[model samples]
Target chain A: MTGGSELPIASNADVVLVRQQVRSAALEVGLSLVDQTKVVTAASELARNALVYGGGGMARVEIVENGPRKGLKLVFSDEGPGIADVEQALTDGWTTGGGLGLGLSGSRRLVDEFDLVSAPSKGTTVTVTKWAR
Target chain B: MERVPILKLGDILIISIQIDLEDQSVLALQEDLAEAVVAHSARGVIIDITAVEIVDSFIGRMLATIAAMSRMLDAQTVVVGMRPAVAITLVELGLSLGGVRTALNLEKGVALLDHVRGATP
Candidate 1:
């Protein structure tokens, strides 16, 4: 496993930058075109959520070699007012922000692994991984 | 702070997206597009995004919002030249974009928009 880079999520421009960076990382993992698109889209949604809802945050990209089954992992962390109920957050059609509410649940469905931890008024961290297939 | 130029031609507004669209830029474009539609008394709009290789859900929403807004103003919108990858990604991200009409290129999109208005130009 190799650690990747960190991207600041302070502004809208950073969102696009991180999306492209994640796409490049996913490409290095040799993800299929569809897989690359999925993870890239997922990255965009998560990064936007981190910036829009979390006030601001950071995104980390990592490359994993799990017994030769290579994959990429994305982590988004924010110090904003965290979600009180993660399960409720993951449910489609629910949003604390003025968005379409598909950012959370939709990203979950795009990748292979999903994990989230958050605390009210503290912060939220979302980790997702997509194995190359 | 990048600006999207909106050109008017015979009651039609055309926006050709040539740069990587930042969120702020897109939002600005949305606002400007709304204003242009009214200012020009445009009957239709055509957005050419052939240069955009990637589109997120937010961008997708922006497109849909533009289409919806144009429709509300009694003007039709046609999004043209969406790369295949972007379309695939949008579908996978669960955005049907049914509210907006799509065409393969700018010519087709203009034709469709003009057809809607019964305009020869």
Candidate 2:
């Protein structure tokens, strides 16, 4: 991680702040316009999930490098009640919160890499990365 | 909480979202638009998002919801000025925004509304 920042997700306003922070990081990492939008949008979803589902958490934005390639990595973690089934949670149109249920699944499609970890009582953390091409 | 202003232009209401919208702002915009449509007796609503940098699921749902609400109020909603990148991201995000009409820009959006309303009555 070269240039990194951490943002707290405690309210709807924080989610917007997360998006702005991620957008700047993506731009700094030289992501194209579309890629920048994808990553920022993903950050928005994950940040909101941390606030709404996780009952507030934190977001870490980092500029990562893989050899000559550079990328943006975002990690969102929360201490709220965790998901019992990761597969069902990742499945599209499956929501426990009456939302569109696309936050997890849709965000996965927007990035190059996705990792989700959670347990019924262990809380949840989602990390996603988008590489510049 | 930023309140998105709704401008009444004839029988149409124009809402240009120029800020990074929080969830509350999105919800408030929905309510404001609904009221504007009824109050103005609007036949069409144009939502301009040219300056918006991103449209996540929440914002996407808001657009769809506003369109649905406007329809029920006898007004057509046309979302215009979506950046190309935003459009691509929206499709990949699985938010097809079905039932919500779109145009390339505000001019086309206004033209579309005129055509739809003219053809209907």
Candidate 3:
């Protein structure tokens, strides 16, 4: 198994850039375009969530092996206002701003596995994984 | 963002969306789409999203809402030119754009609308 890498995203504009990096990293790990697109989309949503809701954060992209399968994992963490109601925030159409509130919820649907950790005032972290199949 | 109306073919309206479909810019497109569908009594509408690179959940939800609204106005809406990456993202975000049609490209989208209109009449 090969080692993984981490990319930091600090600004809103960097979200898109980080997505590209994630795509490249996924490809470097031998993911096809279809799989690459999936990872990129996941990265973009998580990165955007970090920027919009978390007031900016960083994304960590890494490759890992899971018992006969290899996959990519993206972890997005932010030090902004943590979610007050994590469940409500995950619900569709629930939003604090004019947005459609699809960021976190939608991102969960695209990846093979998803996990989130957040609090009211501490911060938020989202981790997603896509397996090579 | 510039809004360019491609043409009015029959009762269907085809418009080219020349802007990044982001959280901030989707609102204008939504309003304009509503107005155009109502004013023209369009039976179908095609939106070109080739210029858009990424689509977050906010924009996806807005597009879904717009499609629903268009249906209420008696018009069917189709989103065209979704990059593979965008489609993957939308699906991952758990957004099911029910009732909204999608095509690989604008030309194909127009052709689909034509077929739909023809089948109806």
Which candidate number has the best TM-score? 2
Colliding pairs, model 3:
A106-B93, A107-B93, A109-B92, A110-B92
lDDT of 1 by residue, A18-129 (tens): 9889989998999988888889889889999999989999999999988879999999999999999999999877887878888888888888999999999998999999
Off by over 4 Å in 1: B119-121
- Model 3 lDDT per residue over A70-99, tens place: 888888999989988889988977888766
- After TM-score superposition, what is the CA distance of residue A127 in candidate 2 from its true location, in Å? 0.7
lDDT string, candidate 2, B29-101, tens digits: 9998888888889999999999999999999999999999999999999999999999999999999999999
Which ten-residue region of model 3 chain A has the weakest summed lDDT?
A4-13
lDDT of 1 at B9: 92
Residue-level lDDT of model 3, residues B1-121, one tens digit each, is 3344445777887766665334444666678778878787888888777876666665677668877998899887889998776776666566767767899887888788788878887
- Best by DockQ, which number? 2
* CAPRI class assigned to model 1: medium
Best-fitting candidate, measured by lDDT? Answer: 2
Tell me the whole-model lDDT of each prediction, alpha carbons only.
0.89, 0.94, 0.76
Q: Docking category for candidate 3?
A: acceptable
TM-score of 3: 0.69
Error of 2 at B108 (Å): 0.8
lDDT of 1 by residue, B4-96 (tens): 999999989999998878889989999999999999999899999898876777788899999999989988999999888778777766787
Error of 1 at B64 (Å): 1.5
